[model samples]
Target: MTIQAAFTLIINTLGPLQGNREAANIAHIVIEHITGMGRMDRVIYKDKLLSPAQEEQLQQALNALLKHEPVQYVTGKAWFYGLEFTVNRNVLIPRPETEELVEWIVKDTHTPVKILDIGTGSGAIPIALKKDLPAATVWSVDVSAGALEVASQNATQLNLNVHFEQIDILDTTATHSLPLFDIIVSNPPYICESEQKDMEEQVIAYEPRIALFVPDNDALLFYRQIGLLAKEKLVPGGLLYFEINEAFGKEVVALLEKQGFKNVILKQDLYTKDRMVRGEN
Candidate 1:
């Protein structure tokens, strides 16, 4: 099959499910990853024929997309904060909004500081911070050993030194012995279970639920626990950053304040959603 033919097939198959623009983007990404052809190559070689193996691979990727699988998971890779990281069903795919959280942390501190990321998932936040702040000592904690494994691999592949630990922050006893940090950041599971119906099928069905959701009655479960832990773990006048549920920004800010954190502030993402909160110890 010709490159254009395969491309058209991919669009026709996934366009209705993912919308035309996104389907086209996923098609290009799949093609680029598989063939390793640059964007210009897709334009110049539109009519070029794909070998039998290339056609088969493209078809397989298209099949996954047709099932509403995220392209990042289908390709086993995700881009975040100007770097690529490996991803799978075990980890939540990194989002652009989280990049804003990382950027905020990077901009807030200039000198060497100890940093810890709660519910690290794919290790995107810590890895990006370490890359930009090489002198910072970064540590990441997650409950799932599988997720920690993926995060650890990403740290190694990115050549960023970050310590990974499997610990459930919800169990305060588990984190009692962990060392204090200069800055603590988390993009924890803030999505309430009731909100799952409103999410994309691809995310709810494929992404790791433990990393994406909280009980409706306890929407701030992770944030609440992390906030408490930060109270004990942060140095005097240290910083706490959270990529919060937009709906609960004020609540999260309040939670931190109640924990004795001061200078609490809420910030919006590029989309202008109240998606981040910061506080000082």
Candidate 2:
């Protein structure tokens, strides 16, 4: 089949699943992955023919997209900040909002600081921070060994030195051995169970639920636990950052303040939702 023909098939098949523009983008990405052709090369070869094997691979990708699987999972790669990281069912796909959280950290602090990232799925936080702040001592911890494996691979591939450890932040006992930090950041599981209905099927079905949710009655579970831990682990004047649920931004800020954190502040993302919070020890 010709490249044009296969591209048409992909768009027509996946347009209903994603919008037309996104469908076209995914189709181009799949073709690029198969052909190894750059963007301009693909455009110039739009009329070129594809081998039987190439057609089969594109068909399989189309089938997965039709099933509501995320394209990052389909491709096993996701772009965050300025780098691409490997992703799988074990970790949550890094989102642009979380990149903003990383940018805030990079912007607020100078180098030669100790940093800890809680729930470091895909190691996006620590990896990005380490890349931008080359002198910072960065460490990340997660509960899932599988997720840590992916994070470790990403750290090695990016050639960034980030310490990885397995710790369940919700269990305070497990964090007692952790060292003090000049900055602590987390984009932990802040979504409540009741909010599951509002999430897209691709996320709810394919992404790790352990990285996305908290009990409905205990919506602030991670925030509460991590906040308390920060009070002890953060050095004097240390900073704590969180990408919080918009619904509970004020509540999270209040929780940190009640634990003796000062200068508690809630910030909105590009969408104007209260999505990030910061406090100082």
Candidate 3:
């Protein structure tokens, strides 16, 4: 069958499980990944049929989507801050809220600064920051080696210089002697365990659990620990930025304040819900 024909058929088949738009998007993603034939190419070659191997690969991709897998995980790539990064089950897919966090960091800095991104995942935050600042030293950390490998591959592919380490933030003593940074940022897992039921199936089911949930009661666990680390690691007057749960913005501000961070400010997302906090240590 022709590429357009396959797209329509696959969308129709998967539309019932998810929404029509999501199904159609998945179809297009599968087509592009399987055949390396983008939307424009398919439009230009509307009369052409998929080769037999291409047809089989597209079918497999559709099957994976039908199982409720995320398109990013299925294709092993996601776009963040206008750049493409490799993604998989090993890490959380970068979110729009985190983009705002990066923006805040970029805007707050005055000169060449050293930046440390905790729980870097696909290295989206550091990579975007480096791409924007060009002169800053960007360092990133993640506990999962699998996630770090994907992040390293993305850095190489994007031709951006980023220093990545597989060190757990909770194990900060192992990483002593690192240079004091000018800015410290994180979009660490802030989702309380109780909030899992409300998340979309594609996220809860397909994204890495290690990168999503905190304890049920101590939702501020990462913020608190990172705040302490920031106290020890950040130079006086250095900035610390976080992408927080809208539900816990006030709580995060309080945590930072308790840790002696000053000028704590909470900023709302595009939806006007409290989504980010920045303070100085």
Per-residue C-alpha lDDT of model 3 across residues 130-177, encoded as one tens digit per residue = 999999999999999998998899999999999998888887686685
For candidate 1, the lDDT comes to 0.91
| lDDT (Cα, 0-100) at 91 in candidate 2 | 99
> What's model 2's lDDT at 237?
98
Q: Which stretches of candidate 1 lie over 4 Å from their true place?
A: none
Error of 3 at 26 (Å): 2.0
Ranked by lDDT, the better of candidates 2 and 3 is: 2
lDDT of 3 at 62: 77
Question: lDDT tens digits, residues 1-281, model 2?
Answer: 87778888888888876778998998887887778787788779888989889888888888898899998998888899989899999999999999899999999987589999999989999999999999999999999999999999999999999999999998888999999999999999989999989889999999999999999999999998999899999999999999999999999988999999999989999999999999999
**lDDT per residue as tens, model 1, 54-109:** 98888889878888889999889999999999999999999999999999999999
Superposed model 2: Cα runs more than 4 Å off: none
User: Which rank order by TM-score, best down to worst?
Assistant: 2, 1, 3
Residue pairs whose backbone atoms clash in candidate 2 = none
Write down the RMSD of all candidates, one decimal each: 1.1, 1.0, 1.2
**Error at 118, model 2, angstroms:** 0.5
**Which ten-residue region of model 2 has the weakest summed lDDT?**
27-36
